[model samples]
Target: MPSSLPSTLLFLSAGIFLAITGTLDAITFLAVIGCAVCSLLTITERTELAYIGGLALISISLILQAVLESKCITCLKADTLILAAVICLTPFQNFKLPAQIMSAVMSVVMFFAVVTVVPVESESTDIKPHGFGQYLEVQETSGEKLTLNTAENPVLLFSPSCSACEKALNKVMEQDADGTKWKLVLSSSKEKDIKKANELLKRIGYTGTLYTYDWHGSVPIVIYTDENDSTIVSHSVDKTIPLL
Candidate 1:
């Protein structure tokens, strides 16, 4: 085997590390390890095990998600990589018809798994905030900018002190961004909360800019605006935001 292949596989495995939720999502890292294991399996004639191994990792990821009630996009991607590698290799090609049939079944299953697991990012101008923001006319706690309903995309008012707020922030950062951009407002009263929230954002590797504010212990809030700057969804920061 070419040495470059292993390097390439590892490079692919690392693609998910760029996610801003790297600190919050352990499943993504697990997928990386699984990919590495598959890479090693490729060196053997039993490369077919790579698919099985990857499938097992995916299963475990899903199980973990079920128990935790959270999903990992990067982990699913890692499994998809393994499935693709298996399809390309097709170790059962020279085997008996029964074995080849089984391979086909596995391939089909993998295809469905990929389709089902990957999340679709919404670019639709109208998104459901799920009844959270109910037309709350609110001004920016710190800045001169006000948003009762603005053209801006969803903005998360992050608080460093609240654990619920942190979890909600993680979900928004990981699930919403598929590439949607948003700005961060440091809207908390306690200086410690602001400081902590900033540090958490940095650790999460959040892609968007953080808007620094002189405001101080306001609750976390999410403001969703339509193209007309009309408030559609308004949610305050808290652990409960995950339900939205």
Candidate 2:
């Protein structure tokens, strides 16, 4: 077997993983194709070109994460794997000065393109003095409405297509949350998203009340309101789950 075969397989695997877990956005889809092309280049002994492609892929991944504030663990894992593939191909790289300069230029262009083209969601700036009550009210007017239990102090904001949300929900299922009345809020109201959310909840055996909201912020958000009237909002699964 060729020594480059492992690197080729690694590149292919990272691409497939991203395709499966990532949203079908233009950037993500193009990245997947880039990975496939890189793998093919590696197999064909064009390691220099493959290495340049790997660098561009890494740049795109990091740029998206920074711009989107995405908390998708699956996307992160795929990026890490792509990095590994790039490292594996490093020893085989032999770029001339002109080629190196061109690669750098290309990366810069891709960076600007992603930043300009991707639509960013604007977050709500209003403070919810009534905590979950405000969320319920907004949902009633714009999205799905649900009755919140007065006793339930924790609310989880998530999106069906979010990898971090799925991980957070899985964590909740694995632990002891028996007495807690948890409220699940979906950030999107699209039919496909709702269908996927319901399927996820059913698979996890979650019996909590699920609501939909027109949320603009990054998700897998956990809101905990203490008895002292203090509201704590957590964005990551690790920070959010411990508070539950």
Candidate 3:
């Protein structure tokens, strides 16, 4: 076989491999390997050197892609691969300019997509009743006060932050069983949150007790008591509570 024939075969194989797999995964990373291997083979004088460089490029690209997806590297592996690939081509004067440009663009877009899909963190808003023993004193809202000293009806423990609490509140209001008095407690950790929950309750015409700024440790819990303040029912404001 002629010297030019081997180089031609190398370029053809690399191109075919890239065409099949490049778009199947990310076009950017795979294309870089394909172009690098093809370029090294077509330009380098020695037959052994061309074959060795192509094999090395494939290995490095595969390893880099693995680390990128796994996030095992310090910086994202995709970014590192792009940087390394550009550096490798810089040493060679005859590189495919268009192929390198496309790979760079694709890598950036993939990174942006990954960032958009990641979940964000939020702070907890459960209000736990603390120091209640001090404020056990009965206070009246809207010139109406229910005695918390006796238990004549079932209590519904609720929190504004809890989806279950909202559903439960709706049920008690719309589907009252024999119009029995159901004590409502809006459990919230912050006074502002409790106040907001109370406003919502009021908008829904809920005449329940609005307990604000009460927390036990880090957890927030709300207690619902009968008109006489006995037979308390408690519910914790947590993520696991299901909506009705």
Candidate 4:
């Protein structure tokens, strides 16, 4: 058995773990590649490759936590473990102890960083209260407060950060007609969130009214009132298309 086999296996396992738990984003792709390279270096017993690969893995992990603002506990744990393993496996003259200690410190810093940087409200389970025909008032981007017209039916509740919302909005725009009245409500009122929402609307050339509402629920929600005045809330874009 190769002396470096355990480290190689650890790196490969960490890479697979990250790929499974993470979204298909650029940062995640880089991290996965870093892990694979680290594993390959370990198997070849190249000290220089180990040093470079280990440094890359450390940087990638920190980027995932601090720069990209990933809050996945599993991801953080995997990163910490991978860092520690890399530090241990790297060939450093009389520096293994210090490297391991540094890895531990980094793990602590990263754990605190993830907890403190992400807001508590992001994890709140509170959902929107009103459903169908309820009289709800939302704030427009122009700073005007307006009530949603239940008679209009089919109000779209979306968030700027949601991919599903973006896809649904695209479909809504494609199917838009001359007399169609499309009402869109931004589900989050955070300044950055509102900015993102507006950017998306502008990019897609949406001219409809966008109101801001403080709601916590699965997005791309389609709310409408039936002939009997009952409110219907749907999460499917196809269900929303006919009404649009």
CA lDDT of 44 in candidate 3? 55
Please, what are the lDDT tens digits per residue for candidate 1 over residues 23-62?
3435455666666666676555455565556556656755
Provide backbone clash counts, one per model: 11, 0, 11, 1
- lDDT minimum window of 10 residues, candidate 1: 235-244
Highest TM-score: which candidate? 2
Q: Roughly what TM-score does model 4 have, to 2 decimal places?
A: 0.52
Q: Please give the ranking of all candidate structures by lDDT, highest first, separated by commas.
A: 4, 2, 1, 3
List the candidate 1 regions with Cα displacement exceeding 4 Å: 1-21, 24-30, 93-223, 226-244
lDDT per residue as tens, model 3, 86-128: 3344333344465456445545654553343221224533233
Q: Which 10 consecutive positions of candidate 4 have the poorest summed lDDT?
A: 118-127
| Model 2 regions more than 4 Å off | 1-37, 47-73, 76-151, 175-180, 236-244
Residue 52 lDDT (model 1)? 59
Candidate 4: tens digits of C-alpha lDDT, residues 140-204: 87778888874575678886655557777888878772215667888766677688677878877
What are the Cα lDDT values of the candidates?
Answer: 0.50, 0.65, 0.41, 0.66
Better of 3 and 4 by TM-score: 4
TM-score of each: 0.46, 0.57, 0.29, 0.52
Clashing pairs in 2: none
Best-performing candidate as measured by lDDT:
4
